[model samples]
Target: MKGQLILLDHLTGPDGPVEAAALMRDGRLEDLFIDSDAPRPGAIYRAKADRPVKGQGGMFLTTPDGPAFLRQVKGLSPGAPLLVQVTGHAEPGKAIPVTTKLLFKSRYAIVTPGAPGINVSRQIKDDETRDALLEIAHDTLDGHPIHDHEGGLILRSSCAEAEGDAVAEDIAAMADLAVQVLNDAEGEAEKLTEGDGPHAMAWREWVTPAQIETEAGCFAHHGVHEKIEALFRPEVALGSATVFIEPTRAFTAVDVNTGADTSLAAGLKANLALARDLPRQLRLRGLGGVVILDLAPMPKKDRRSFEGALRAALKTDDTDTVMAGWTPLGNYELQRKRARQPLTDIVTEEMLQ
Candidate 1:
């Protein structure tokens, strides 16, 4: 019962900070008490300086270790897009960015705009998706301009010796976890009252298909189109407000502004809403590290009531989130486990706009 447990999944992000179990033994959940300071384990590679070879577009470097190093890069596939740090003496003291090519020997996955190696063909199972994948692949891999495809690729992991159905199962499990997290957060938020902050909100509006087409056409003409258009679906639009629940290397600072129409009653109502809603957003966002929240400053009496409400909100999040007392500057500090990249990074820019 005290042994270490390492859950591996290809679909899981590069950082596996979130862990769940059916039971906890003597306060040790899954034989590991989640620590905010502990670093997540995954394979990381950096380009070596000596392996430089100049090309027409720019200079590039090959991993001298050959197929073995390439294998390592492929192994990290489906986790997070590989983070490649470019370094060279191009401008003496300055570093030059280089392009990389990730070769996946297993599956011929298509490279999407934001998500590089995401297999749109496999996911959509449609002709348009397949064609898009192939077109992008051929262009990036064998186009006239000689494109650089150096990034993360998904290949079988030699360390785990995972193969056949086992690898597929691992990928499925990771997807399940991600789905479960989202679903559970949504379900929990629905139980709260309107005065309880908006863990999630939906707005309904009537719009003709023609209106959509016209707007989309306008954006497309401007050379601005997003791959993930589902998020923009006007059908019962879902909006959720999240706070920086955790602090990592990049600190999260939230500014709370009292709305123009807010009254004394509405102000207290909003504060209570934020208190109930903030924790859920933190979990949903997967925000880790240090989070600073600037709530609309209230009277001394209201502050005491707000503190209790805030503490209650923190309990809703399944993740190990801790609410530190408010700072002298009227900001409150909280900590959540940093798992994957922020939601803003995950969503498309056009959808955000």
Candidate 2:
């Protein structure tokens, strides 16, 4: 059971429900998801455009919850109702960021509204499987009266191994939901769909089979509380090296230090170790956007190897991330998608409530 054992634990917090999904591999916390009360990313809303921001080329809209901002508002009229999806978690005291180009995403399919094309994931490489998945997409979507203005379907990678009936059902459900939301344009500012909470999201995305622990206090039982407490601290010790992660107002700063290792390859070794661990750290902490990495003092020739390792690590990761190359001062830059609420913010919000 060294690496084969995996656990999905849903635990209760002091406030009755923490609404967390913790994934443990071989008794080690692998990934964590804690539900946040903030305006969740990917929620669909029928919002009313309030006003346009001059020079910013964006519009501020009013939702049932609060004000939301959308970019590239060329034809959106003031007070006009439009469908929008939350793009990311809102910064503290800022308008919730939203986009008119809405997407209905699920485990097996994604319905792209206003973009018409029935496609399969590129990751589904087998010719026969791709063809079958394509056929399934067409067969399921062809009967639906999807207009040119309406969106198209893209079968997700998960569909390749999923049961055909289940894939078709998932696609159909998303398509039906999209049509319903798009046609209802007469409503006041309101939410059309609430994004998936922790438990539901875990079931959707964490497709690997695992031992399920739904009983309360499972988090503490699995040492998840200790792991989470460590995330609150800035320094993470990776063997003999120490990496400091500090999030500032403008960007998150990461510094790697080779502690007590006087070997000539210490910098490269520590940096390579960081290359693998950094993604997991950022993911669990829910930190995204511009990340500045001040790697240990490695030779300029070793940068390529470090980058290759980093890229490989990120490739397996589900989140969208792009390497923005290095800065003039030898710092590596990464631009990651704002996919989840920061762990700190989520805990603080719950405590205050």
Candidate 3:
């Protein structure tokens, strides 16, 4: 959520949907971007509830995908129709989480049925840009439909570089979807529309952010579709540093290799670059929970500065990340609660039936 979420302009096949990838500031993958799809997280589905398990305080709802758990627990009964927003997908032994508080996400905003003002992402650290986006949000409220929705647009970082027209387009789309959310909430409709406009694009496959050239890289082969396929790769080389990422059952560990340059300055330099890119890699790969960075050796004082850079790098990460401090052995510890499935899980049999 902290990155620039853009749909790759290229289509995989004739009449295919565009691919979407969420990229961090340093341009690393955040998650597999599926713009609009049924059964995905954040999707709203109309379902019918079975009787609540009185002891468990929640009931199972039959959705188009399958049975899901509705945890709000009140006023729900067998055969009751409900409009539920999927909070998460079905895990190994865990039921998918759904709620009545419907959420609609557009390119520039998050529309919900609660508050009535715009809120920008704090990651948009540039004061002027933030102010500009806010002004744009305010403008949307001037006779805009759905302007009355409680949770206003929480501008994504991409809004920082967006032209006024782009922001307006998103606001317009939000307004359109806001109406659906309201209608659904008021029982006038049981369906929720994501939106229509530039942000409501569809995609059939997910490619690495590395594959799509932003204002950055590009490709072509035998007049064929081509891209730098690194979205699922776990290691990256930066200047004199090579960071290796290993995700385990308990935590994700990242090790920095200085590659024969063991001098203090070399180690510090490599660690510095790693510190900056490590957070990008972590967020890119969704390596949440108990992350330990095994950095190139640096003095205690130097590690303090290194830690500062790493923290600075992490500022761009919107996840609930807590820095657990460095150990005496020069390894750094941090915890970013997993928000989505890690790339390894998606690439492996974890998601398989």
Candidate 4:
């Protein structure tokens, strides 16, 4: 199986989410998750410029979707309506990232709101496949043109494998959504206060209902928050290996060990097995930034082999991760870039209150 789907549910208040986190894991593979409460990477919003920071970080703007820090400095003025799309989600103390170059996401393509041309994802790579998808997208949109619509199509990498009918359907659907978004922004007169955007989970409100029906043995659990809380424990054991996951102010450290009576071969095997769960745990726990791995000691000649094995295990991690190599203290250092609060921290906050 590619992955085991773990349904995530959120506890919510009247306005929106109080908690939402989803986890997906398969045998010895990296885990996948969806942080519903966090700002989505592709959703668009119509924001009004607040005030420029004068060569500082960026411009602050308010929108119904969320408050975003716009990096476009020049020609931006206060109280003007501007359409933007979220480029990144929020972190503990920082605002979410956004851009004026808005784009709408689809299963096979991205629909740019006001642009006039189609382009394919550079990662699609093969010239012939890229050209075929481009032709299909342009032809589909041409036959189904909405009058004076500003919709433009850009094929996603996955479209390289998508059937022609699927591509056409997605293009039409995304273009329709884009048009609706543009239509709404013109009439939107809402203003933002500090509390408005931080808690809403927009994706949940928009998810396709068929998604839950399609996955076998993976239905939304009645107690999603409870499941999330259960997995938030600091340590967990798998087979002969016990993992110690501790998050400090600086970084999160994951240590792997076998019971004391084990021989070197057993311990090494345990370490290799633990490698599969390491990336899975990081993602499930929403651990990001610098991470340290402390595995049981191995032969000097085997260090390279262990690192390669660990790399193979982490190849499925969707978040961009880079191995910073080993540290002087005999721990392996890695970096994963993502923005969100850890589930452990979330638990702590609830416990405190």
Which candidate number maximizes TM-score?
2
Query: Which 10-residue window of candidate 1 scores lowest in summed lDDT?
Result: 196-205
Q: Candidate 2 at 139: error in angstroms?
A: 1.8
User: What do the candidate models score in CA lDDT, each in turn?
Assistant: 0.35, 0.84, 0.61, 0.63
Per residue, candidate 3 scores C-alpha lDDT tens digits across 164-282 of: 98888877776676676565543322335432321232221121232333331121211112112453566778886787888887778888888867676888898899877776566
Candidate 2 lDDT tens digits, 263-290:
9999999999999998999999989989
How many clashing residue pairs, candidate 3? 5
Candidate 4 ranges beyond 4 A from true positions: 1-41, 52-57, 64-67, 71-81, 112-132, 143-154, 157-163, 179-230, 265-271, 339-341, 344-353
For candidate 1, lDDT tens digit of each residue in 138-254?
443342211232222232212122233533443333333222322332211121111100111000001011111222233233222231232122121112222223334566655
Taking all chains together, the TM-score of candidate 2 against the true structure is 0.93
Task: lDDT winner between 1 and 2, please give it.
Answer: 2
> How many backbone clashes are present in model 1?
13
Shift in Å, residue 165, candidate 3 = 5.6
Give the count of colliding residue pairs in each prediction.
13, 0, 5, 0
Rank order by lDDT, top first? 2, 4, 3, 1
